[model samples]
Target: MLFAAGCLAILLGITHSILGEVLVFKRLRENSIIPNLTGHKFNLRQIRILWVSWHLVTLFGWALGILLFLLADVNNAPATLITQLKQVIAIAMCGGATLVLLGTKAKHPGWIVLLSIAILVWFT
Candidate 1:
């Protein structure tokens, strides 16, 4: 479970960075896909900054997930603390996924897979 979660976290981190920094930001800067899809005028600099911030947040989330997995594997903490940590991770991941799916209507497969893995790891 820990291994699976760790690997998924790393994969998601990479995917998020690529999608946000390269794909989405590029489109926004070029005034191409995003303006058409969103139907909103965006200042290139502001949009770029926003996406960069989002990318950083995603990377931070992945780092936290990895840290949690390592802490669980080491078994160096009290049982209660570990249990609490797992619950927090589960809630955070699931809630984030839910927001992405419903709020944004995102078609990204990576998010769906991340949500599935998060639920599975939480249970197992």
Candidate 2:
């Protein structure tokens, strides 16, 4: 459970700090500033660069996280339970990923996934 919890913490942290910035602050930073405006002269481009770099790094982090979570879950779970739970998790995860990938960030989709995770946690 500790390992799974650790993975969840890292996952949530990356989702919030890294991906959330991309999803939230990216637009704000884009629209908030006027291009070619000079501060220290380095400020404008720096924010853009930071945004891009952050997104890129977070993409990598997410990729790593998917693999890590998969491995961690597999490693921690007993074989019988793993088989029983695999299909449910796959459906929930893949369906959730598909919905999120389709450019829908509505609360419904995320909440559904959250509820499914809750069920999984409860059952397992």
Candidate 3:
């Protein structure tokens, strides 16, 4: 279950990035819908920053998933390390879920998978 949760987290990260690119950013780009943070050329800087920030979430999730996967495969790991991993992963997942839920008013599906991952890690 822990491995599966890790896999799901990875999958979710990939899906989130792809969907955001195709469904959100593409349309925004096509329509020139990015908000202007500065008066002139500096507005492009805002777009670039926003783009990087958007993808950073995906990268962070990927890192967490990779850590979970690697830890799941560890043999004879110390109980303290396992306990710490469980706590960290579970807390991160729950925090991410809460953020998504509140940030998007539950419109985004990421919260569901995130909460599911947290539950799996908790039970494992």
TM-score for every candidate vs. truth? 0.44, 0.35, 0.49
For model 2 the TM-score comes to 0.35
**lDDT tens readout by residue for model 3, 1-124:** 7688889989998999888778756644543434223433445454544554466588668768866776787573688667777867787777777766654446567779989998999889
Q: Sort all candidates by lDDT, best to worst.
A: 3, 1, 2
Stretches of candidate 3 off by over 4 Å are 28-42, 76-124
What TM-score does candidate 3 get on C-alpha atoms? 0.49
Among the numbered candidates, top lDDT falls to 3
Question: Model 1: per-residue lDDT, tens digit, 1-124?
Answer: 7767777777888888777757566655344433223316655444534553465467557857666566657555677666666766676567666644543336434458658866976996
Instruction: List clashing residue pairs in candidate 2.
Output: none
The candidate with the higher lDDT, 1 or 3, is: 3
lDDT of 2 by residue, 31-116 (tens): 44212232344554554444434443444444444545555565456765455445445544544444333323232244456446
Off by over 4 Å in 2: 1-6, 9-43, 73-124
Best model per TM-score: 3
Clashing pairs in 1: none
- Show the lowest summed lDDT stretch of 10 residues, model 1: 30-39
After superposition on all C-alphas, the RMSD of every candidate to the true structure, in Å, is 8.9, 10.3, 9.7
Each candidate: what lDDT? 0.60, 0.47, 0.68
Measured with C-alpha atoms, the lDDT of residue 25 in candidate 1 is 60
